[model samples]
Target: MDFCWSPTDPVIALFVPTDADEMQPARVSLIHVPNKEELKKKNLNGVRDCKMFWQSNGEYLAVLFNQFNGTRSTNYQRFAIFGIKDPGIPLEDFELENENDMIIAFSWEPKGQRFAVIHALDQRQNVSFYSVIKSHNRFQFSKLVTLEVEQAGSLHWSPAGRFILVAAMRGCGGDLIFYDVDALATLAIERFVATNIEWSPTGRYVATIRTLSDELDVRQEEFQEGVMIWSFFGVLLYQIPRRHFTQFWWRPRPSPSSCTQEMQDVLEVVNELDIDLDNDLDNVIFFGDVDNEDTSFHIIYRATFHLESTRGLGSVVDRDWTYDE
Candidate 1:
């Protein structure tokens, strides 16, 4: 097995990179979380090594594999989709159907049912989209559209699920491609080969770290070893140079946006009450008196007034103090 994890579900999806047979069909195993028992083992459509991906929502899992016929010199690719709820069954399984095309890379839109694939046809690569649908209580997958792109690498969707970045890795000599899902428009910036891509949690910025390869020219080599931050609209925001830089990551944001207004109001009221109680304690005065007895200190009365409260609630504490010296 190459990799395995629970992408958001209780069941674990394990990807076996290759099969025992000479056909080398990629296999995936779905195991139950409670007993660690294998629920289903599925053989994919294509024969060569495969890559596994899961949608962020965990509703769908996709496997992309390459196929080659002995009579043909070109490579062929296909993808299979499995539903998490029905691990034993495939939701959608088929080849690309596009003539002489191979799927290079694909990515799921974060928290969404839509996904994009980078496919190569006639030695040209482009972007294509697919969406999950339900009708008559049966789930189905449908192709939406395709966009022309010069080359393909990896695809990354923003945390907000609004934007996607197409990374052209080292030696591809392709620029960064940014796509806006709602608008169905793409923007490309020239002269960049990204080794790694990271999206800010707020979806405000994208970080692309330059990849160093033997194909880089002297001019490209001079500026190709740094981190560049770009806005979602494909504008160059900033870049930091470091030849040895390897990775870039953004921290996960908190859930403050999901907090309701009423919740915020209640939190504010509680905070105010806490501050009022603290202030009242600070104002409390401590007084002690020595009694006629050999060893005794007496507190005749103690009062605490909550000045911050509108009702001005006050309490009195009284006790006799006696201690052996």
Candidate 2:
């Protein structure tokens, strides 16, 4: 079972696969969280897998299903869009013009009435943008534009919308393309051998990370595992090399209205503490005075948090530290 919650509403969309031996069709449903009521349900056959994507504002939900053709030994894809806010919860079905073209990635523009799809055919990949258009009292998705992108495998939209990062990660050479939707122009193009890409909550910065796995033997000189921070415009700001790096995450910032007076007071005190990164012995609090080299310690440092003055400012610092498992 696969499920996703609506960002702006108390509705959850779920997809349950079929049991082939039992001859049951796949099912999709939307449930109201408060009342535990099912708002919509649909059953489909020949579906091998299902994926659900909810619009940022909870206006619509798109369910992509991968279907198999046993006779032809081939696969195709189709999608259904559910209108969440509309009465009766109407659904519209759609498929690609060329059903044989495989879909590589899909992403909805944040708080926008558009979505993007990366489809490939015969080793050629293209990114297509579609807008939800309203005409004659009904809404439908209309193709806006399609661009051929080399080795594009994924899409990452900014939190504020308008800008999108098209990247080809893993074995695709980590090709990065920053595009502007409003201007319909390519902002920048760069490359990094990243396994994962993520945008900052404010959409000001993006981090491209290269992580190492325990099972694989990787040459350090060939694939330097680390994190590279870049601006939204595709400019590399900083690159930090970390040995055996496994994961990276951005700290979320709460809204101004949610900030209480007590939280602000604590942040003010935290901002006053000085951080000295150069000296390891100074300004460091050791948990135990054990002289053994294997002993682990927790060190706290004052870091800067990017926020308004009224909200207070502090960030968690990441450093090379040994910890007990």
Q: Which structure among the candidates has the greatest TM-score?
A: 2
TM-score, cand. 1? 0.67
- Candidate 2, residues 10-56, lDDT tens digits: the string is 88888888895838888998999989899999887788679888888
Mark the 10 consecutive residues where model 1 has the least summed lDDT. Answer: 288-297
Q: Clashing pairs in model 1?
A: none
Q: List the candidate 1 regions with Cα displacement exceeding 4 Å.
A: 15-27, 44-48, 67-75, 86-90, 187-189, 211-224, 242-247, 251-325
Distance from true position, residue 213, model 2, in Å? 4.1
Q: Give the per-residue lDDT of model 1 (tens digit) for 1-325.
A: 6655657767777776654555666677878788888766777544557777887777777877676676548667767677776534545675665857767788889889898888786768788887778655456777777877776678889888868887677655676788888777776545677767877766777788765656554365455575777878789866656555545444343477876776576446546444453233322221112121222112213212222222343333332221211
What's each prediction's TM-score? 0.67, 0.77
Please, what is the whole-model Cα lDDT of each candidate in the order they appear?
0.64, 0.72
